[model samples]
Target: MSVLSALGSINWIAVLLAVVAYSALGGVWFAVLFAKPYAASLGRESLPQPAQPALFFGGPAVATLFVVITTATLMAALNIDAAADAVVFALVVGVGYLAANTVIIAINPNMPRPLFYGLISGAYHLVGIVVTALIVVAF
Candidate 1:
């Protein structure tokens, strides 16, 4: 099935709730826990704040889409049927995201602190996991 068709089988309310919760988790993590300190450490004058509501909303929406696609693909490829499989998938994706971010930061030292970026990326992927789990459970 196409990604959209797979996602169409899900309960959107749960999917959205997961996305919002995850996005809020990330926003708080970046904005409060790491934003200023990370920017200062990089000798940056300021971090780029969201100029529009969409900027804040768009990311999680895209992330949710990504999770849906990934989960659907994995479920098909691995024949995943258990909650444990969903959890494992989340962990694997989180690790892969961290590694990718590490490479990106290594290539561009001007990027935010490794720990900060890693945390952000990890949390984002975890959120994706939760969203995927909710979809699988609901469906």
Candidate 2:
């Protein structure tokens, strides 16, 4: 099926909920759970306030939306109505795409501790994707 057709099959409300759920996970993961390790991953003593706090927060929300949309589209296209299949799809996409990309993105000149950053951020995305899949399939 075409991309447009796949999009048409997606449940928008589920996508919205999944987006919100995934974005919220970012807060719990980065701010509350792994705050110290996250800071250290950046080679910092603590979390630095971004000059543009809006971008700091809003950027992830927007990215979360995109991720949910993509996952939802794929789910719809593949006719993944079952929870078990949804989870399998999530794991494959999460590990193969999101986590791998996170690690690759972490390996840069600005990242002093790339592997550490990857461990924290990649794990967050992995869990977030699973949450997203469950939410989407539930609806």
Among these predicted structures, which one has the highest lDDT?
2
Poorest lDDT segment (10 consecutive residues) of candidate 1: 98-107
- Candidate 2 positional error at 3, Å: 3.2
TM-score of each: 0.60, 0.93
Error of 1 at 112 (Å): 5.6
For residue 13, model 2's alpha carbon misses the true position, in angstroms, by 0.9
Show how many residue pairs clash in every candidate, following the order shown: 0, 0
What are the runs in model 2 whose C-alpha is more than 4 Å off?
46-52
- Sum up the clashes in candidate 1: 0
Candidate 1 lDDT, 4-60, residue by residue in tens:
565455555655665665566666755687677645645463757546577566876
Task: Name the 10 consecutive residues with the lowest summed lDDT in model 2.
Answer: 45-54
By TM-score, the best candidate is 2
